[model samples]
Target: EEDQGLRFLQAGTALGTHKGMIKIPVWDCKKNQQASCDLSHRKNMEPVPENDTGQPEWDEESDYRACTYCKDNASEYLKHYRIASWFELIEKTENLASHMIQRAAAFSMQYNGGNLQLMCYPRFTATVDDLMSDLDELEGNLGFVPDLIILDYADILLESGNDERERLDRIWKKMAGMAGKRKVLVVTASQGTRKSLMSKSIKTDQVAEDIRKLAHIDLGIGLNQFVKEDERDERKAMIMRLSVMVKRHGETPSEECFVLQNLGLGQPAMDTYSFLRELADSWALLILTLIFLGVIGWAYRPGSRALHDDAADVPFRNEDPEQSRPEQSRPEQSRNDHARQDGACK
Candidate 1:
């Protein structure tokens, strides 16, 4: 019985046994034009054509905006862009994964010992069916099914124009179905509604196009920040709140606060200074309360009774001198009347 229990424990403790690779298929949509442009600049190549009219010839196959590089050095630029796009995608995914791993470590989850692999698909444009087919191919090549899939900027899969909400809902539902069918975790992101941009904190309702998207997600987290207008110095750290809008396995509708070390990237770190400041404020308020009570006690002390009485009577100290003199003279006149009565009786 002891040996059997030891074996069972060992099996359970085995690391990376069921762990699988994380595959991210990045869709290099037109939304990432700036990143592509930056890549071209780094390669000392002009991404945009600058003719006399300063416009590149439209290439409908490549979705228009085909620059001179695409026209002249098509093969070379294609290879370069593909490589650069993959690098950009991998870098971002790794950064996010690292951040997540750090957070998980705090909860005593040893993700570092897990079998994690990153696979990038650059310039991938395909329908849901095509994506599944490609995933099948990837499984065949890798000899095992992926446990996690990330579709970067998943909204780009939607068709442009006309009933965007309906289209987004359909796409998200299909993605959710894929997750269920594959029995794998599918992670994607959607843009927030315009109103969400102005909001200090975002909720499931703030998801762009359709709030119905929340129904499909097992877990959803919203990142929010509110920068005060007076915080002119960029060096000053800002606070960001991460709210768990949806959760299936654990607690939902929870929030945690962190200070942003880099506002541009919105990287969060513990705000020790803010914690200390709050502690100081609490101590200051307690000290002030004690001082106020002490002052009150001293003012009403037994030794201060005469002083308090005099202070209380100070309000009537400015009475008219003529009015007071009249009262004193009436008392003397009453005594004199009594004396005169006695003399008359005698």
Candidate 2:
């Protein structure tokens, strides 16, 4: 299984707190084919072809039904997804949102859908055929045929001890094979060379093993973002601006696109919280009114009256004989001491 556990203690609590602070409400109508105000949850889940709109069709047969109904867990009907990981340096992205997040183009890694299966492969010894055999077993047993496959590190598939470039060449071809044979989209990652790390953007020439590795890819986008020392501290670096390095079809626009992200919340850039700004705008007056009322109530609460009265009298405490009685001897003692000092000086 792909371990969703975090490394540090209280990580989950900290992340939960962060998520609570960001109040991005996902309405059910937007997530379903039915626009419902009072929609109920569906019991059973089944696999279905998903459209790119990111909404869930709760009823597999209800595509014709109105999507205007607000779905409670509209996204709950997706196919059983399992996170399968192998003994490799890389990780796989199983969903379109995650795929785009890694590439820096999308948002939201919610937990309600898809079973992610993480399969561990032997280090630098397994072959693509061995991978196919395991996948075949997975399908035959679990009835889980993936539409997408992510190979954490292809270098582990074969001996990486010799012919680095040629090994990369073989590795990419094998990835292509997995895609074609399984009829699924295969995704993997490649790190940049040391020189490329220093550069603001990684170029095709900087691809570690072989630039030709991209030759087999349908679309390739280079990752880049603002990483000034100050910006890194502010986490503005999560605002990713990606450059399209290669595209199999269509013109590659020179213009770039950005996705503002906060992974601490386990969310990609969900509309960059632009929708949140709209929400605030729509409800600003009410929100402000409630806040004002709360402050007023806190200030005028029953106990606060006595507290404020005591504070108001603090400046005039010396005028009240009863209040000053406890300290009446201090000044006389100080004066007597000063007189004694004066006499001694004389």
Candidate 3:
């Protein structure tokens, strides 16, 4: 809707009644002249009661002049009278836009956090290269990998049974592995066929149930609900698709909502499983390394010349001549004493 001031300016009229007295503001159409309110009736009105000797107090707020009766609706007149300029309007608009963008960014960061990585899977019309490029863009917005991702218009692949479906399945299967630490949500419209038949193109019930177990949200809207027969059925189909997409993927346009849930808690579960496996492997390696190092140290040990000799080798040291010199010297002394006694007897 157009602003009220803008509307009044365009129409060039302000309709107002004060206490049953009607006043019409007149604007000079000839020139952009300044407008002033005619206070003839205000002059007729009695003044406030005060002491005869006392002067009426002046107020800066009340001193401001009101708009003229004639040009009250005139844009130029209102601009001057209301003290609103075009530059001020432009400034307000810019500030409002900035505030809105900042608010959206803050809310997204608060809810999703930085740990969550968000990805988008557009329709099969997008190629692998296209997907990768889009992924880069998404990462730029998030500043990190997303813990959750959305497959937008996934039904497009279902339409084509060949390579497109294969590619999507492959990608999604890989994504599911990551889902232990992250999540992937797919959004699509439900087919209007009979639910009794197991062959409906869109299995809304089954997908919803499965996704719920996976902790992914699925929202399906039936196409038969909206009444837009005046336009092409494609229009109705598009709306159904869009509504389904928004409910499951979040944010109507892909550009608008780029954030995904962080799922940091999911990481701990993945870490626990990984850590146990790593710990087991590490324990095995540690035992093997200790045995190998012990054998090497035993083999490389200084055999006989070590500072601390082995107990088995200490016997050889005791058998050495230098180690038994005291016993050998005692035998020599007996021989010398025999020789001396024989010489003395002679």
Instruction: Tell me the tens digit of each residue's lDDT in model 2 across 1-346.
Output: 2233331211322232221123221211222322222325422133222345532323334333222121211133222211110110112223223333342211123321335555776577778878888889988888778777877777556745478888888878878877877788887777777776555566778888789888888888776553343222113324445677778899975655445554545555533322233334556788899999987776666645423555443432325434654654888989979998999999
What TM-score does structure 3 among the candidates reach? 0.22
Q: List model 1 lDDT by residue over 43-125, tens digit each.
A: 33324222344322222233322222321233334333321111111123333233444543542344323344333343335
Whole-model lDDT, model 1: 0.51
Question: Looking at candidate 3, what is the lDDT of residue 86?
Answer: 10
- Whole-model Cα lDDT per candidate? 0.51, 0.51, 0.34
lDDT value, residue 337 of candidate 1: 93
Model 3 stretches astray by more than 4 angstroms? 1-98, 101-105, 108-147, 153-224, 228-346
Please list all clashing residue pairs in model 1, or write none if there are none. Answer: none
- By summed lDDT, which 10 consecutive residues of candidate 2 come out lowest? 81-90
Clashing residue pair totals per candidate (backbone < 3 A): 0, 31, 12
Name the regions of candidate 1 deviating beyond 4 angstroms.
Answer: 1-124, 158-161, 230-239, 249-251, 259-346
Q: Could you tell which candidate, 1 or 3, scores higher by TM-score?
A: 1
Model 3 Cα lDDT, one tens digit per residue, 1-346 = 2343333222221111112222211112111112222334121122222224432222233322322322333322332231110100001122223343464455456655665443434445654345446656766875665544554443343233455435445544434444443344433332333441332123345342123322232344323223332322221111111222224455532211111111211110111112223334546677889999986676456653222434444433435434555555777989989998999999
Error of 3 at 86 (Å): 38
| TM-score, per-candidate, Cα-based | 0.40, 0.45, 0.22
Provide the clash count, candidate 3: 12
